[model samples]
Target: MKLSTRIALWAAAVVPVLVVLAGLLLLPLVGRDLRHQQDARLRDRAAAVLPSVRALVAADTRGRPKVEQNQQRKVVDAALDSGVRVTAEDGTVLLSVGPQPADDRAFPTAPGGPATVRDRGAAWRVLTARVSGTGANGGSGTLWVSEPGGLAGDQTAAVRRRVLLVAAVSAPVSALIGFALAERATAPLRRLSRRAAELDPAAPPTPGTGDGPGGGTNGGTEGGTDVGPGGAPFAAVRSGTAEVDELAAALALLLSRYDEQALRTAQALETARSFSSAASHELRTPLMSLRTNLDVLAAHQDLPPAERAEIVAELRDDHTRLLELLTALGTLARGDLVEVDSFGPVDLAELADAAAADARRRHPGAEITVELPPELRVFGWEPGLRIMLVNLLVNAAVHGRGGPLRADPARVTLRLAPAGPVALLTVDDAGPGVPPGERETVFHRFHRRRDSPGSGLGLTLVAQQAALHRGTVRITEPPTGTGCRVEVHLPLPDAGAPTLRLPARRDWITGGQRGDRRP
Candidate 1:
């Protein structure tokens, strides 16, 4: 049911009960007040007739019947609506007048105040006063004045009826009022619902799309107005209600998350397609070579030892190239789909040392030198950084051979140091350096020299990871030698550094886009 209707029903149910409870408390007080008023009237009447009662007592004591009868008339006249009874010292009833208890025993000789006396199912409030003559040893008697107890009860009953009538009347009236107020209060919520219903999830609002409602844009969230997240242009109504405003904000946030997830899902699907396409296209040559070599070996069992060794060596190279190609494709896909949550503080100095050590193991004949500080940290994906370091060292090992005029073994230097807010890493290789014109193209996906043994993805991976870490990578001429220097500058982790925000647009696999930092 509607909120307003619920409120109205609750008010209707509760108001009458509250009114009745109030009446229950009020009834006793009202009854007591009526009784007090009656008692006061009885006391007034007793005072008025006291003088006449004294005269009657005196006249009866002197044995004058005529005066006693006249005084009795006066006492009855003064008694008015109340009941009166006069008695002498000897217990002789001088007079009885008006409404009263028929039993004389019911009246107290000297009542402290107004007291109730009952006779034959009837009740009265009685007050007694002393009626005495002026002289000593004079005739003394009690004057009793009373009003009916039922008068207060009747008044109380009338008030009780009125209270019940009020209780019965309040139910519907309170319900109507409550419903009207509730309806008015919920108007903003209803409007919010209507707007939310009109929103199109498939085509959520984007900034600068348009100004119309749900047209994919909001003017701005200036003042207190709020715009929805994830390009949802829902401008919440500023209705001076906290609950409604908060609900609008929460809804906007939810939509934002939905939009983000949808984008990620689309990107994941695209990355998967590119991974399959690239793998098929690149692996075909190596696979064909492997098969041809294997078929030749199977067809010719009596071949020369030299010819068999050459075919076996060709098979090994093809197998290694095929493995490297698959590994590179997988790494690129990972980089494209990586989330910022996977990033953390990674020590570049330590990672570079490890990569250099691994390279030395692989190329025992090559001389590798590393100059790094004790620690150099950057906020980045640890695995990606490790991949980058290994790729850079391996690229140098394979392509960075020593010149014919220099030495037999290749020489490479890996260096790490902090430069301002960034950690600078440089790999110097004593080999034929890349040309100035082709330096930029070397980082593109699957681009390699004819004689290069490694997959072309090595430098590409280096560029991808540098961009991922909010860094830059570029090739330059070595300062002191005729070789290539690949310099990478990655941002350093700091205590007060702002949180890193990943790039929203990534299509490294499908687009074959170079991962260089855009100038």
Candidate 2:
């Protein structure tokens, strides 16, 4: 049943039962009142006739028949509709008129005032009063008045019938009234249900952060209104009912969150597919070379030492290449899959100094210099920053070839300084610098110099980290004009210290580098 109908029915059932119970409670009091009134009337009649009864007793005692007859007639007139009886002091019957008990003994003996007297299948209120004269043996007697209970019983039955009729009639009337009110109350909920049913979570968000039909904007109706308020499913829907609006708002919030998570899930799946495809394509060439070198060594067990040594060296180089390729690919996949939890405040200067130190250890043949404070912090993922810095320093040490003017040991300089709300980093090489046209392409996956001996994904890793940190990287000629300068800029942590977000399109290892250029 509908909620309104159910409520109405409950009220209907309960109201009739309550009326019946009230009737039950009141019926007895009504019946008693009728009986009491009858008793009072009987007592009044008895009082009125006492003087007449005394006169009759006086007349009878003196042996005066004419006076006695007159007194009897007077007593009858006073008693009216009630039965009247008179007796002498010694129990002599003086007068009997109207209704009386079949057996006199069944009446209340000498009833001084109103009293209930029961006989076979009958009931009465009987009142008795003493009659007195001036002297002893002069005039003394008792008068009795009686009224039957049947009159009150009849009236009580009539009242009971009326009470039952009213209870029966009110049941349906109350039910109809209750149902109408309940239906009116629930009308808003039904409207809300319809609107919610029409909501399409997949509907695209409006351009420029405005509210839409199903999307909330900022906090409002997909236009960034108060989605957190009483509008659920869409905070813009208000029905003027607190509970309904609150429920709708809650439901809208849940759906909006679900839609958000759904989009993220779809993006994650696409990134996973790209990672797999790239991994397979890039690993094929190295795997083939490994297989060929292994086969050559296996086929010639007694080959000359020099030839064997050369083959063994080639096999080792292929194995190393496979390792580097897998590591770089794994790192790129991790960057693509990074979540907000992986970020924290990292000291950019400290991170840079550490990266330069590691590079120096890796390349003792080159001279390295680092210039920066010990702690210039920026909100970022420490590991991603470390990866970016390591790549830049390694690239400089390897490719910053003979000094611009003369052959000299490779020299690399790392610098860090704050620029407005951003941290600036620059790595300058003393060797040949990057060409003007190829500066951007070098960050693409697997792009390398023909003579370079490292995996081409190093600079790609650098680009991924920079993008993940909401930072930027670009190549230009160093101040000295000898080698390329890799300059980076990362937003500094504000007073509020909010977390930085990754780029919206982060599939750099899967042909997303086209968006990496400055326009």
Candidate 3:
């Protein structure tokens, strides 16, 4: 049922019951009050005749029998009008009046006190008083007065009827008023319900962020609006309640977040597609060159010694470079796909030591020195950290300029220290440093200095590794003032274990090299 109707029905049903209960409680009190008034009238009449009865008794004691009879007759005559009766204790009737049967009895043995009794079949209310005298001839006597109980009963019944009548009449009118008030109170809720019912979920309203294409003037109706892909617009229904407005605001916020995430996903997909296409195209040229060189060698079963040896060496170097380039590309792709869960606590000093040992074994001719602090802890992926350190050292060893190919030590130093909340790893070389203008470009994918024979992805991988750990890689001039120094600043883990931070934006490296003038 509607709320108003329900309230009305409840009020109608309950009010009459309350009225009836009140009437039931009040009827007895009304009856008692009416009986009190009747009793008072009876008492007043008895007092009036008492003086005359005393005079009659005094005459009887003085031996004036004739005067006593006349006085008794006078008393009896007066007492009849007041419904009273008088009697002596010695079985002598003094005066009798009103309805008193031959066997009708007075109140039993109540001395010196007023008593009451109901007369049988008469609807009368009665009161009795015992009269006492001093002389021997003057004995105790009884005086009785009565009034009709019918008047009190009728008054009580009248009061009960009046109460019932008023209750019956007022019930419907009070219920109608209550229903009207309830309807007025629920008007806002009803309007809100109707507005909600008209809303279509399939075509949700577009949110107005500002004065954009989808946004309109005047804050766009103070409600949500949905703009479909084909430029269709629909207005969301507004509930004027504050809680509903808050809910709508929260929903809009969630939708906007979803849109941003979807856009990022699309951009990442596009980047992957481009990477795959570019890698395939680039690998084709190297593969073709290698194939051509092999074909030429195969055609000559017994070639000139120097020529044959030169061709074989060229083939070996190309093959090695090709393998290195492909490996670097694969590493870069893996870094791109790395999620936050792959990170953990790593000791940068330990990683550096391992990288140094590996590099020394790989390049026995190079001079490598490692200066690491104890337990230089950072949060990052262990494999990525190792790859970054090995690449930095290798890049330095391959590119550092010293004596003519063999005499000078290719001095490389790996140092790690705790700098505030960051673990700083710096790789320094004794070689011609990156040109001031080209330092930033060297971190871009496939970027290389003109004289460097290394694949351009080495520093790019370093950049990616630093980014995954919420860190940064920068090229600073070496402390020796002669060569390049690469510093990676990684955030230290609180529990000495690696924790992943927010994913780094791809533009961290790309944005740094956008305006490069190098070919």
Candidate 4:
């Protein structure tokens, strides 16, 4: 149902029930109040006739029955104005007045105190008192007074009837008023809905200058236009209520996010299509060269010994280089698809130590040194961290050419430390430093210096890993002014006394070392 109709129906159903409950709760008190008023009247009448009753008893003690009867008659006469009935002891009827009793119920024996009784059959109220005295004929007697209960009943009935009448009549009337108010309240939301329904996502947004129908761009559109990225526009409709306004704002925010994501998805698809085409084209040349060389070598089984050895060595080296290049390209592609959930906490010190050990083992002639704080930790993906470190170390091993050139030993250093609220990892190599303008370009995929013999994805992987960790990587001259330095700064883990957990194994395809388990 519509909100206004629901509100009206709810008010109609609930208000009458509340009215009836209120009446029910008040009825008993109303009845008691009526009885209290009757009791008060009885008390007053008993007080007035006390003296007359005493006088009648005194005469009876003096043995003058006729005088006593006359006194009783006088007492009854005086009480008649007040609606009283006086009865003597010994079951003698002295005087009876006011409304007659419906039966011989003996006026409900007052016990010389005040009391009230209801006569439902006669629909009357009665109060009685026991008359007492200290004279010879005065042990106990009764005085009774009665009035119609119809007065109180009528008053209560009038109140109840008025309450019910108000409830019945005002229910629909108030409900109609409520419905009108609700309709007014929801009018803005209704307008917003209608305007939103009219929007067309497929249509090109109206141009800036026009005088055509449907508000013709500049004049006034069916709804307000909110500009999004790439100059596209979306409808922005608003409801005036605070809650509805907030909801509209939230919806606008979500729609903008959706537009941004759609654009990103389109861009990613285009980039992927281009990369696939280029990769396929690039791989064919290397494959054909390797196959032709292998076929030529196979066909020359009787060639000179030295020529055969040289050709076999060249083929093996070419095969290795080709495999490395293909592997690097595959790694770069995988990095492009990395998502946020691939990140977690990683220990930089442990990653540096492992990278140092691997570099020493892989290149026995290169000197590797690692300087790391024992507990340097950051929030990052373990595989990405390993990839970054391994690439840095491998680049140093491949390019730091200092052993025979100037009698200075080539050295690679991996250092990690806590820099303020961030973990800083720096890899320095005693090699000819990268040129100032080429520092940033070294991180681009397939962009290699003329002297480097390896696939150019090493620094690209480093940059990608840093980005995935929400960190930054920069290449600069080393502090000693002799070598290239690459530094990565990652945000530090949350501050607390650290808890130790088992470290996870890193992925091999992402440049992580495999098969070294820690228990």
Candidate 5:
């Protein structure tokens, strides 16, 4: 059921019950009030007839029949509707008037306020007053005045009937008022629902830092507006009502999260496609070479030992190439799909040191030098940064050797330091440098020199890691003037810095160098 309808039904069910309960509480008080008024009336009647009662007692005691009769008439007149009975001090009844029990024995003997006295099946409020005449004809006696007890009961019954009528009438009236108010209150929520329902999740989110959708850097919609498909605004309703405002804010946040997830999902799908395409195209040559070598070994079982050894070496080279290509592609895909939550504080100098140590072990003939600080930390993905450092060192060791006229051992220098808000790292090589015209193209996937023995993805991995960390990478001339230097600048961690915002466009493996641009 709708919220308004539920509220209305609850009001209808509860209001009448509350009214009935209030009536139950008031019933006793009403009855008591009525009884008090009845008692007051009986007291007044007893006072009015007291003098006449005294005269009647005196006349009867003196044996004057005419006087006694006249006083009896006066007593009856004063008593009105209430019952009265007069008794002489000598224990003889002087007069009895209005409603009364046949025997006066049931009357209250004490002279005080009115009290209930029952005779046979009837009840009465009786007040007793002691009267005495003045002067020569002075006499004493008791005067009893009472009204029917049912008077207060009848009044209380009428009040109960009226209360029941009110309770019955309030149910529907209260329900209708409650429904109307509830409907008015929920109008904003209904509008919010309609606007939310109109949103399209597949539409690309407005870029937070670009001129996309919501207009430059305002994050798609300004103020409290959310733009849906076709640029229609899903206005964040902020009625003065706290509940409605809170709900609207929650809805806006939910939509923002949905857009973020949708973008991430699209990126993941693109990465998958690129991974498949690159693997298929790049693995074919090595696989063919491996197959050809295997066929030669199978067909030439009686070939010379030297020739057989050459064939086996060729197969091993092909196998190594295949393995390196696959590993590079997998790492590229991981960088594309990485989330910011995986990033944390990493010591770049430590990673560079480790990479240099591994490079020394692998390329014992190469002369490697490292100039790194004790610690140079940055906020980044540790595995990715380590991969980047490893690739840089390996690339330098493999390609840093000179042409025929150069020295026997290759030379590579790794350095790390801080530059303002960024951590600067450089790898200098003493080999033939890349031409200036080709420096930009060298970072592209599968782009390598023809004579190079390594996978071309080494520099590409370096570039990808740079972009993922919101950093930059560029190739420049080394200080020696005869070789190349690759410089990577990564942002340093700061206590008051805002969270990193990764680039919205990530197409590393899919053939676009957009992600490598210096931000």
Candidate 6:
């Protein structure tokens, strides 16, 4: 049912019943009031007639018939419309006048105040007054006055019937009024519904889109009054009603989320395509080399021992290179796909120390020293952080042999300290430093020196991991200018606390890491 109709129906049902109940509650009070008024008037009549009644009784006791008849006339005249009855102390009937009970036995014997009595089916208010003389002890009688209850009762019933008619008439009238009011109240909601129904979800309003019909782009929201993202105007949802506005806002938010998800899906697809294309291009040369090596081995089984060993060594190098390339590519893909849930509190000191230890184990002759506190916490994905540190150490092992400025070969130092709120980790190597121009470029994919052994994905992984952790990485000359120092500043857990929040955007493989701070 329509809201207005429901309101009208409810009002019709309830209002009449309420009116009737109010009348019922008032009826008793009104009836009592009527009886009280009748009794007051009856008492007044009794007072006026008492003197005459007393006189008549005294005359009768003295045996004066003329005086008794004169007093009886006076008593009857004073009684008026109320019934009157006079009786002596011995229950001897003295005089009767006006309207009264036909049966004298029905009269109250002892009546001081007004009371209710019935004769036949009619109710009456009766009052009794003692008619005692000041000087004449000859006569003492009870004077009775009575008035019919039906006088007030009839009036009350008439009023009650009229009130009931009014209440009955008010029901449909109230319902019609209620329905009109309800319709007026719900007008905004209907408008909102109509406008919302007209909206096209597919052509959603986006930020910076042109204003369309009604001087606004009809996109994200449901109305024309409010401008949504891209400045598109919503046509109808928010109709100035609080409930409608709130619902419009909720719907807009939901649609906005759906759009964001769609965009993310598209980005994910693009990232996958880029990964496949890059992998194919990079793998072709190595695969060709592998095929050539295999062909040579198969064709020449009787080749000299030294030549065979040399070919085998080259085969091993190619195989190893291919493995490392695939591994680095896989790791980069994982970093790109990493979610926020994989992140947790990692002690930078502990992680750096472990990486330093591993580098020491792998290249014992290469002096690797870690100078850091027992624990400095930062929230990050463990595998990503480990990838960053491992790549740093590996880079130092491969290329950071001591240069002319420092005689020691492959010596590296890692230092960790707090720089305000961020943890600063600097990996210093004792080798010829990276040039100022090439520092940033080294983090780009497939950017490597001609003679570089490993795949060029190592520093790219480092950059991706740093970005993933909402941190920054920079390459600069060390204090002595003998080697390059790569500094990574990760916003630390406040006072050894871990706060894991990933960056807003993550497509490191497809979209390059744009926020790497350079020095």
lDDT of 2 by residue, 1-519 (tens): 898999899989998888889989988999999988887888688778877787788888888899899989998999888888888888888988877666688666655767777888897777877778444666787777877868788998998898899889889998999999998888988887776676654563321132221112322234323222122235446778888777877776665555445544655777678778887888888789888878988998888999989988988888888888888887887787676678877888888888988999998887889999878998788888898899889988888767445357778899999999888899998777778889888888889889788889998887777666667778888877767899888888897853443443456655666414320
Lowest-sum lDDT 10-residue window in model 4: 210-219
What pairs collide in candidate 4?
A: none
TM-score for each candidate, following the candidate numbering: 0.80, 0.65, 0.56, 0.66, 0.81, 0.75
Deviation from native of the Cα of residue 449 in model 2, angstroms = 5.5
What shift in Å separates residue 340 of candidate 2 from its native position after superposition? 3.4
List the candidate 5 regions with Cα displacement exceeding 4 Å: 44-86, 90-106, 119-122, 135-137, 199-266, 289-315, 401-409, 432-438, 479-482, 498-506, 515-519
Among all windows of 10 consecutive residues in model 1, the one with the lowest summed lDDT is: 210-219
Q: Model 4, residue 254: what's the lDDT?
A: 58
- Per-residue lDDT of candidate 6, residues 30-121 (tens digit): 98888888878987887788777878878767778998889888988888788888887778877876777676766777757987778887
Please give the CA lDDT of all the candidate structures.
Answer: 0.81, 0.76, 0.68, 0.66, 0.81, 0.75
User: Which residue pairs overlap in candidate 5's backbone?
Assistant: 214-220
| Candidate 1 lDDT | 0.81
Residues 332-421 of candidate 4 have per-residue lDDT tens digits of 656544544676677788888988898899888788988888877777678768888899999987777564463455588888888888
Q: Give the winner by lDDT: 1 or 4.
A: 1
Per-candidate alpha-carbon RMSD to the true structure:
5.4, 6.9, 9.5, 10.4, 4.7, 6.5
The order of the candidates by lDDT, greatest first, is 5, 1, 2, 6, 3, 4
Candidate 5 local lDDT, 1-519, one digit each (tens): 999999899988899999889999999999999988888888788778877777787787788899999998998899899889888877678877788766578888888888888888787888888878644877788888878888888888998999889888888998999999999999988888888777765566554444221122222335776555434456676788899898988777666555556656766888899899999999999999999999999998998999999999999999999999999999988887777789988888888889899999989999999999999889999999999999988888877887676454679999999999999999999888889888888898888899888778999999888877868998988987977899999989888987765665567777665324565
